[model samples]
Every structure is written in C-alpha cells, then in structure tokens.
Target: MPSLGSFVLTCIIIAISLVLSVSASVGNIKSGPSPRRFMSGSQRHNATFSLTQIRNTKWEPREMSTTAVYAAEFLKHKVQMPKVLRLAWEKLKLHDDQSSNSSIHRRVDGQLVRYSDGQYVFPVTIGTPKQTLNLIFDTASGDFWVWSWLMPMDMLQNRKYYNGSASSDATPWDGQSWGATYAVGSNYGIVWQDIVWIDAIGVAGNPIECSQGVSNWFASLPGVDGVLGLSYAYNDSEKPEPQQTWITYILPLLAAPVFTVSLVHNGIGTIDFGFIDQKKYTGSIVYTPITIIPGGGAFWAFNWTGFAIGSDKYNRTNIQVMTDTGGNISMMPESIANRYYKLVAGSYKQANGAWIFPCKASLPNFVFGVGSSRIVVAGKNFILTNLPDGINCIGGIQSREEDTYVFLSIPFMQSIFVVHDYGKMRMGFANRTWV
Candidate 1:
C-alpha cells in the first residue's frame, strides 16, 4: 500500500493529468464519482490509437542479427543486476507483496529493432513550435531522453535531433544532468522542462533528456530520436534528484491509472492510454502483482504458478519473469529451453547462442500461468525468422544467463492485451484477437 503521503502525491500528479486539455492522446483524465468507474469499459474508452497513426515510416529490413537485438535486451536487465530469482511463492505472499516497487510517477512507450523493422517505432513532437522525431516506445526502462543539437554535427549526420532552444516553451532544468548507459551504447545529457507530445496528447513541462553525445549503437537506428521511458520513477537514472518519465507526467492525466500494449507481428498494433478497449481483448483480465525482490527496483517482475509446453503437462514450477517489451525475444532457464527444443526435431543451438530449427518444423505453443489463467504463445510466434538459407529459423525463446530469471518479450506480448497498472502495482493480461 502506498503511504498516505504517496497517495497524496499520486493524487496531486493525477491532478496535473486532469488539467491537460490535449484532446488527441490523453482524452480526458476525468475524476468520476467513483474512482473505479473507468475500470470497467461500460464508462468510456479514451485515447485509443493504432500504431499506423503514430509510427515512423517503415524501412526495408536491415541485416542485423535477431539475437543481437536479444543480446542488447538481455544485457539491459543484466546491467540492472536484478537480485530476485524465481522461487515458490504462496498466493498469500503475492497478496502481501504486490507492487513492491511501484512508481509513484512513471511513464512508458517503445520502438523496435531490425531494418525490416522487427520492433515498433513512433513519432513524438517536442518543443514549443514542435520538432517531430521518431522514438521507440520503451515501457521497461526509465529515461525519456533523445538526441539533441548539443551533439557534434558529424555525429548526428542527417538524423533528426531535438533543438530545445528552438522551442519557445523550452526551459533548462537547473543543475540536472542525466545518463542512460546500456551495454552497447550510452546517452548522456542535461534536462529540459519542455512539452513532450505523443500524437495530439502532450505532457507540458515533462522532464526531457537531450543527449549531448550518444554512442554508435543509438545512432545506427535509422530514424529513432530517443526513448519514451514508461517504467517506475525509481528506475530513472537522473542524478541528485530523479525526474519523472514522459509517461509518468501523462499518467496523472489519465481517466484510469493504466496503459495497454497490443503488439502484432507484421501487422498494425495499438496502445490504449487510459481506458481498457474491450474490442482489443477477450475473456476476463487475469491480474498478477509485481513480485517482491531486493535490488530489483527497475523492472516489472512477476511470478507465475508454472508454465507448460504445447499440450504437455503443465509444470507448476514457480518462476519469476521480468517482462520487458523493449527487447524482441524471450530468455528462460536452459533446462526449460532444452525441454522445449527437444520437442522440435532438428533444432540446434548455434555459436551465436540462439536456437535454430528447420523453418518447417512444427513448433508447439508456449503457455505460462497468470494466477489460475493459462496464457498461450502460439507456435508460430516462437520461430523468430527464416535464416538466409531460408531453411533454418531463429527461435524466439532462448537460454537465460541466469538460471533463475526468465525474460518474457515478443513471444508473450504479441497475443495479449497487457494492462500495466502502476496505481495498484499489478499487471493484467487478457487474450487479444488481432484483426
């Protein structure tokens, strides 16, 4: 439970959300007679938009390796050094430990990798007059910074960068500097009090990180400007005093304290800002509280009763999974990965650490527990892509560096309507039917 002070602070933040009059993205961050009114779709569905409306122009697929995308994502969590290992947990413990490190003011969004564009990318407008740049909607990490005019001209090349000075409404955040150092690259910059807009909905004076210098890893992305971070506040990398992410500022203005991601492969997807879109998901939404762990404040860590492969018996092995959409693949226990591949004939582990199987092999469905619910990842989602030979294909689920930690990504997200409820510190999952 949030302390009285935290609840008060949350209300104040939501009050900010309520005040934003942007009619596009935010809708109306209304306070109903009943706080739970929007919890049910009978009330209103606000700010639901398809990816085609916000995404950058799609590019031809690039030649980067899929596992490289996975490795970059794997290192992201590894660098966080989460100390929680998947272990048995009683429902009583779950009830007690829900939302262990909930963000008081957090925001999230994402982008994808691969030239053929395996990931999703969207455009965001910043500054007074507005400079539009394409960015990844990253829900897991917490630094909402982007490329800026402060970097060397050669570094930016022809890529778009934010000119904060050009925005009449931009103001330098006094004495605040920030950095996001990932395994492959780093983005470091000073803070700005500026408007950050996702489509028509904008957060006024949101904390924006404008990078002075970024590594090749970031610059390599064709049209990406930066990340729109939507994780908890503690995960923010600001020094001295941390600032809220863009989504954090947006969260306060929501009709309900929630956001939903509906990811589809090779097709248009959608993101719901404040209300649940019944049209996107089916069945009852199963809720799971964020797991409790020391030194794991930076993730949406949750525990599952167990998982099963295809029609095989459901293994009630209690394991903790760190759900992140920033990355494109999933990583699980080697034992589990081995068992899964055993069921796929001619599957082999390549020197690159990714599992490959004949593209024609029949892959089984992957299912995991969410309370008593069984959420399934269809067999087709498991095969990442056809290799150059067009014979073998990459498997989406790989072996984790840590035996106890399982990372769930595309295979898990593509077919589900994921409700990230920061207010209550629980994640809700509903089966989604992609149109």
Candidate 2:
C-alpha cells in the first residue's frame, strides 16, 4: 500500500481530470457543431384563458457581452448548419410588456414581447399563484415545457424553475413524460396538469412538461425559461403518445384563427393572435400557401419565387424557405450567399463558415419574393456586428451547399412583417418600415 499523502495526491489528480473532461465537453458544444437545440416542443396556446393582445411584456435576449467578442456567437450558428443541412441534404429544419422583474415578462393580452440576444419570448404563467416564465414562441416545433425544481444542481444556472408543488392547480397528468434529445444533449421531464394563463384568465387542466433535467445547451441561455410551440402541424415527437398542443386548444377561440409575428431589428415587436396590425407594414399583405415538405415540415415552411441583390434585377431562382424567429441570423444556399456577400467589398468566408467583411464595408440591399410580391431588406442589417479583432465584422447571412431551404431568422425578419395564417393555411409577408 502507498503512504496516505501519496494516495491523496493521486485522488486529487483523478478528480481534476474528471472536472476538466466535463468542461471540455461543454466547451465543444459551445464552439462546435450541434443541430438547432430545442427547449420544449409542447409550447401551444390555450383558449380557456383570456387570449388578447400582448401589451408590453419585456425581457432581455442573449447577446454578446461586448460587440467585439470575436466569433463565439457566430461560430455556433456555423457549426449547427452543416449537421442540420447534412441531415436535410436530409432535412431541415417576442413580446412586450414592461415588468419589474426584467427577467420574466408579465401577462398581457395573451402575448409576450421582448427582444434580447436575438431571441423573442412571450409571457406564460403556470399553476395557481401564477408562476410566470419567459418562453420562446417557436413555430418550428410543438411542445410545451419549462425548467423545474427537479433539475440537477449543476444544470440549474440560477434561472427560474417551475415549482409545481407551490401551485394550487398542479396535478399529475396521465402518467406521461416528455424528453427532447438534441445533437448536443437532451432535456427530459415529467408531465403535470395545471392551469396555464397567458392573459387574465387561466386555462384549467392543461398539461405542461416540468423539465427535471436540462442540458448544458439550454441551461446556458439566460432569460429563456421554456419554449411555446406555434407549429400546430408538428407533433411532439418526444412525448410518450400524441398529445394536444396549445394552439389546437386556442384556435377555435380566435376570431379568425390566425396569428401574426412582427420582429423588427432594434425595435419593439410582437406576436398578436386574432388581429393584424396594419401599421406594422407597408402595402397589402401577400399570401402564399404553406408548402408541405417532402418528409414533413414542423416549421412554417414556404417557397419564394426569386430574389435580387442591391440594384440588380430579380433573379428567378426559386427555393423553399423556413422561418425561425428564435434564430439570430439567416442562412441560404452557398450560391445565393456568395452572390450577396460579393456585393460587400472585402467580405470573405471565415474558418467558422460565417462571412466576415470590413466593419465599414458598404452592404447592398437584399430583396426576396413572396409569390409575385417583393420585399426589400436593407443592406445595413447584413452587417451583424464588429469582431474583437476590430478590423472585420460578421455578416448576418451565411451560406452552406447542403442547405435545402432558405432559413430566415431575426435579421431577415427585421425588415418585414410575417403572418402565420392557420385559418387559411397560408403565410403572409409585407415590408416593415422602421422610420
């Protein structure tokens, strides 16, 4: 046997190694390729509560600590694209209310609106005393889940967790459980029936997944407590059985069975149910029928007739497109992205796969078609932000060859207003004006 000090030293070495291993694993997720990680697939709207206009629920989005923080934020997007596209080569794939908490948006007209770090969230309250949580309204998925007190200590990042026992209206539901596994890791939880309130009233006996385990990916995002799925078309693949989504419950209660999402760059935005805001956009709304994908599209996927760069005439290059409000940037086929970036002098693809250009490079306007209609995106939006290196800046749009469909996110959305029309099974688009 060895002396006591020698044994203790060996144990310490082993412990340190284990800790570093765990840390490096997480570091890889942050710096490398992982598919679009999802929080909750069951985020649907419920009608039993008062569903009205979301006034001004507010929370900050995840943003870089400083504008010049190199490419950590941009690199993650680049890494996710290849894996996501290779599978689609396989597939694919805000609110306002001013509240004191600043972390959670207060309930309003059934809507939550806040903007930060390029993520849009809505206000949702669960349980009797109304444990409010900030949830991202993701249309690409369908599942409703929130962080729970049951989460492991390490995974809990000082964020809000749903305490089901503290709520008077909480109960077990059908012995069901849900889990969403992602390219990086997985988050799983138990199900409970509780009253969910978005507006003033509450929808009773609604099933919500209380996440007992959270992956480092989801836990790393601040302010985003859960995901509310607006994609009524997609089923919750993680659930033990087919479950009803919140949108299915609330659709019948809507005046026109439609919802609109307006996400403007550097401005207040909202997702309103039942009515459209005419002031948000210019010209009449152009509608395109929802295009079903080859396998299936959980997102509000559609097609555009063509596009034009700067003063160039429109090119009739048709492609399928998907709208993802939670994403910080936009992506397209390498051909189109190359064309767009070429117009910006000094722009070049970086090792991480994102395009970089001089911070002061003149960017050309980008315009894409909505059927016969056309919407112009300002060139400035393409200049995402400056880099820590100081000489260059990252462009908002990136390119990948395997990208089967154009992925539009907050940057593309800043210059346009989008409507997800469930009533007619069509998607609408119109130009947005910041001035």
Candidate 3:
C-alpha cells in the first residue's frame, strides 16, 4: 500500500510508543503503593522452603574491577564515635611467626563483648580473683590488651599483671627477648615491646598457634578497659587485601556470594555467610547506594529512611536516623515521638514500660525517606510479638525499637542481605529469594 520508506517510518513510531508505554508501566509498578507486593501471607510463612532449596554453591566467580571512579565518588566515610578508656591502663600484645599465612590465623574467636554508653565490658579469667579482671572487646581494631596499670593495690601486691613477677596457673610469654614496639595514641592506644610466648589463644571461632606476643597502643572506647582487634592486616605490608579472618576463615567455606551478621539482644548472634533466612526474606531485596571508606575497610552502612515509631508511615516526617551495629534498641528523640503519637493507632503508658495494641483493621507501616525513594516497612518486621502490648512508649507514642539505622545489626541483617564487596563502594540487596 504505502512506499517502503513510509512503511518503515510507521513501524519505528509504533516501536517507540510501545517502549515508552512499557517503561511507564514498570516505573509505576515500582513507584506505586503495591502493598505486600512481593508475597502473600501464606507465601511469607513458607518462604524459607524456597530459600533452602536455592543452591548458592554455584558461582561463576568473576572478579569485579574493585577500582572505579564512580565507586570512589559514591563512598561514605566511617562514623568516628568518641570513646574513652574505662579501666585505667591495660596492655596486651600479638605476634607473627612469619611462616603461617595471615589468613589462616584470622579465624580464631576471642571473647564476645558488648558496648554501652561508650564503655565495653566482658569477663576475663586470669586464674585468680587477683589476676583476673573485666575487659572490653572491640572489633574495630586489632591488638589484644589488659589493664596493666591502675590495679587494686591488694591484687597488685598478691598477683601478677604479666610483669615477669609471679606465675599463676597460665603459661608465661617470653617477649622479654625479641624486639617489640611500645606505641600509644592520644586516644589511649598502647603498645609495648616484648618476646612473650602466648599460652592460650582466642579469637572469633578457631584458635591457632602462638609464636610471638607483641602489643601496640590503640584508640579505645571510654569506660572500656581492654580492646580486642578483629581488624585485618597489622603487618602494614598487606594492602588491597582482606584481613586474615575475612579471607581464610570466612571466605573459604562460604556457600553463598555474601554473608550477614545478626547480633541479637544480649550478645547472642549468628553469622550467615551464604544466604538469607526464609523468615526475613519475604520481600524483594531493596538496594540503596552507599559510599565505602577505603583503608578503614567496609563500614556497614545503608540508605537512611526516616524512623517510624509505630506502623504509621513517616515519609512526611523529617527525623534524623542512624544505624549502629553496636546499638541494641531503637533510640529516638522524645520531642518528635510525643507529637507523632496522636496520629498513630495505639495507646501507651505514662511511666517505665512501653507497649502496643496492633489492630487487625490497620497495621502500621512506616515509610522511610531514603536517597530518593521511600521504603515502607510494616510493624510486623520491626516489633516483637512477645512484648506486653509489644510496644515501648517513649515520650508518649508507642514506639517499637526500629532498626532503620544504617548499621545492619544481626537481627536486621537476618532480614536483609547487607553485602559488603570491599573497595568497590557499592552494596546490593536481593530478597532472601535471591540470596
């Protein structure tokens, strides 16, 4: 009917219109308030079976270009919190035999510690009441230490502070012979030179041989006596490299491409290296752009959505939000919460405890303001069902401790994949289905 050129032009116009239409449809679907878009109720309860059936062992491992200009630009700096020393003076040391690969030794488990109000506390067995003391365990740095100074005068006179004075039940180190360094930072970093043979070794999971014992000064938390460095690469010669534990202990046995750390309340935690749990992975994996801090390693981060006290979507509310792997509960400003309570569908107490009454007619879903999008999380995901009414009334609103902060704690990580592919500066999220 029509000339060849005219017919071709007509086809092109039709194709363009189709593309535009399809794109618009997709954008609308993603942008729309598609409640429970990823799954139905029955599906959510049974999602774990789907997750277990997934074989994460299969991987066509391709090394990505870790160096990218765009990635560098997307990097966010690590949060530097003000920490002070709790115990007066504690000194600990580490050593390298020069023969074993750093990776193999990184898998050991030290004491699990908890942080609160800028202080750290953990039980230490030093063979006797006089020799033993409480210490702080830190993962941000490397270097094992104990308070060597400011000892109880009675304990000082009766026991040993690893000062080559008394031998209790433990094996003594011989650091007196080898060359060591005594380094201290203005922030209570300490290091001392000595050739000490470590009698017992501890770390995260596996313990290893102890050939030499060296100590160094470390910037520590306030009110915390000891610091346990879970960081990598103390020799300073290793770069563009993961710490020994990250490489040898964790990466070697991982069944999946990613791992998550879930630190539950009271220091009970689990580290899932390969996949997401079925219970938490009911929704689509949401990805937020993150900036990684180089050299300091990957600081766990996320796109901050606004904090929701209850189920009400706070997309319109402007609130400051932060995530802390170290934080145990959702902490919010009382002023903002007091005002928000009126709009929420719940009641509360005036005194010590906080509780919630979730109505079937309306379950609260709070939406957070991320980089560009609003992330809606239902109360079921944020609050526990076991609480009295399952809500804490801070100020006046029934606020469930929300994990909307940037630091993906163990419980929150159980709900999402917090992927940290170091140095590249980008993180990814896929529903547990994708994990």
* All candidates: TM-score: 0.77, 0.73, 0.35
| Runs of candidate 3 exceeding 4 Å displacement | 1-189, 192-258, 265-267, 274-280, 292-298, 305-322, 329-417, 427-435
- Judging by TM-score against the true structure, name the best candidate: 1
lDDT preference between candidates 2 and 3, better one: 2
lDDT of 3 by residue, 1-435 (tens): 000110011110111011000000111111111111111111222111111111111111111111110011111112221111111111111211332433222211111111112112333333212243333322222334444432335433432243312423222221111111221111111222222221121112121111122121111222223323233224111112212432222332334445443322222233343455545444454556554334434333444645554554454543333233322222333344343444546644322223233432233433445544444333333332222222331111123223222332222332333443333333454334211
Ranked by TM-score, the better of candidates 2 and 3 is: 2
lDDT of 1 by residue, 1-435 (tens): 000110010111111111111111112323211111111212232454434324344333443343343344545554322222111112212432453321210100111122233234666788778798866665666767778887899887778889977998677765566765543335577766676666556656677777876644455555567776677555666655666555555565567778888877545566677777888888889999987545555567788889999889999978888776665567788789888999999998754456778888999988889889988777777766566666777777777545476777655677778888878988888876643
Mind giving the per-residue lDDT tens digits that candidate 2 earns over 50-119?
2222222333332221111122222322333444324321111122123333223222111121213313
Estimate every model's Cα lDDT from 0 to 1: 0.60, 0.58, 0.27
User: Could you tell which candidate, 1 or 2, scores higher by lDDT?
Assistant: 1
Error of 3 at 136 (Å): 8.2
